[model samples]
Target: MRVLVQRVTSARVTVAGEVVGEITPATQGLLALVGVTHDDDPAKAQRLAEKLWQLRILDGEKSASDIGAPILVVSQFTLYGNTTKGRRPTWNAAAPGAVAEPLVDAFADALRALGAHVQTGAFGADMAVALVNDGPVTVQLEL
Candidate 1:
């Protein structure tokens, strides 16, 4: 599993001109672009969610949990895209939808279990994501 974590001031995901998920945090928050691979399971999702909530990237090096920050989780199989061979990218490292969707849900659920406010985009929708990245801080984690 992998996640692209971005600290943001506000963010939202829209589908077909309709807002699907949104968050305008009172304090700094995170946007987690989660991807799943063939070997990933629910356990990995849980661990990563906990790690994301505790990650110290917000103001004063505080964690999302520390500041009661919300997290917007989006399914992003492209995180595993590979382009080492040719101009076109390959999806060989990404898990098939059947294997990925549930894990994405598990990731959000884990965040909720950790007392983090979790918002999310539709699993397989064509979404327009908007965000104001705070400090322009972004981090990537793979596990």
Candidate 2:
């Protein structure tokens, strides 16, 4: 499991010109782009979700666990994209939708279990995401 965590002042997702999810301007919060690989396990997805919830990237060095900040989770299989071969990126490392959708949902559920206010983009849908990246702080997480 992998997650690209970005600290954002605010974030929103739109699908077909309709807003699907959003986060208010919080003092500290995360925009998490989550990905699942073919070998990824449900337990790893759960652990990664929990880790993101508690990740310390906020101002004052407070973790998300300390602040109860909201999270915007998006399914981003592209995190696993491989460009080593040629001009085209190969997505063979990414799990197929049938296997990935459930893990993505499970990851979100795990975040919810941590008491986070989690917003999500539709799986397999074309989405436009907007955000005011706070501190331009971004981290790539794997579990």
Candidate 3:
């Protein structure tokens, strides 16, 4: 599993002109673009979720786990795209939807279980994400 974590003031996802999920501006919050791979297991998803919760990237050097900040989790298989070979990105590293969707859901559920206010985009839907990136801080998480 891989997650692209971004610090955001606020974030939202829209699908077919309809808002699907959002996070209100908190003192600190994370926008997670989550991806699942064929080798990823539930344990890995759980571990990554725990890591995100405790990741110390907030202001005052606080962690999201400390401040009870919200998290917006979006399924983003594109994170595994490989474009090194040619113009078109190859998605061989990404798991197929049948295998990936459940892992994505489990990842979000695990984060929520860790006491985060978790918001999520609809799985497998075309989405438009809008965000006010805080500090322009971003990190790639893998497990």
Predicted candidate 3 versus true structure: per-residue lDDT over 44-108, tens digit per residue:
99999999999999888888899998899999999999999979999999999999999999999
TM-scores vs. true structure, each candidate: 0.97, 0.96, 0.97
lDDT for residue 76 in candidate 2, whole number 0-100:
97
lDDT of each residue in 1-143, candidate 2, tens digit only: 88999999999999999989898884668999988888888899889987887788898888788998889999999999999988999999999999999999999899999898898999999999999999999999996
lDDT of 1 at 48: 94
- For all candidates in order, the CA lDDT equals 0.93, 0.90, 0.92
lDDT (Cα, 0-100) at 117 in candidate 1: 86
Tell me which residue pairs clash in candidate 2. Answer: none
Model 1: ten consecutive residues of lowest lDDT? 20-29
Order by lDDT, highest first: 1, 3, 2
Q: For residue 87, what is the lDDT in candidate 1? A: 98
**Residue 57 of candidate 2: its Cα lDDT?**
89
Task: Decide which is better by lDDT, 1 or 2.
Answer: 1
Measured with C-alpha atoms, the lDDT of residue 128 in candidate 2 is 97
For residues 73-124, could you state the per-residue lDDT of candidate 1 as single tens digits?
A: 9999999999999899999999999999999999999999999988899998
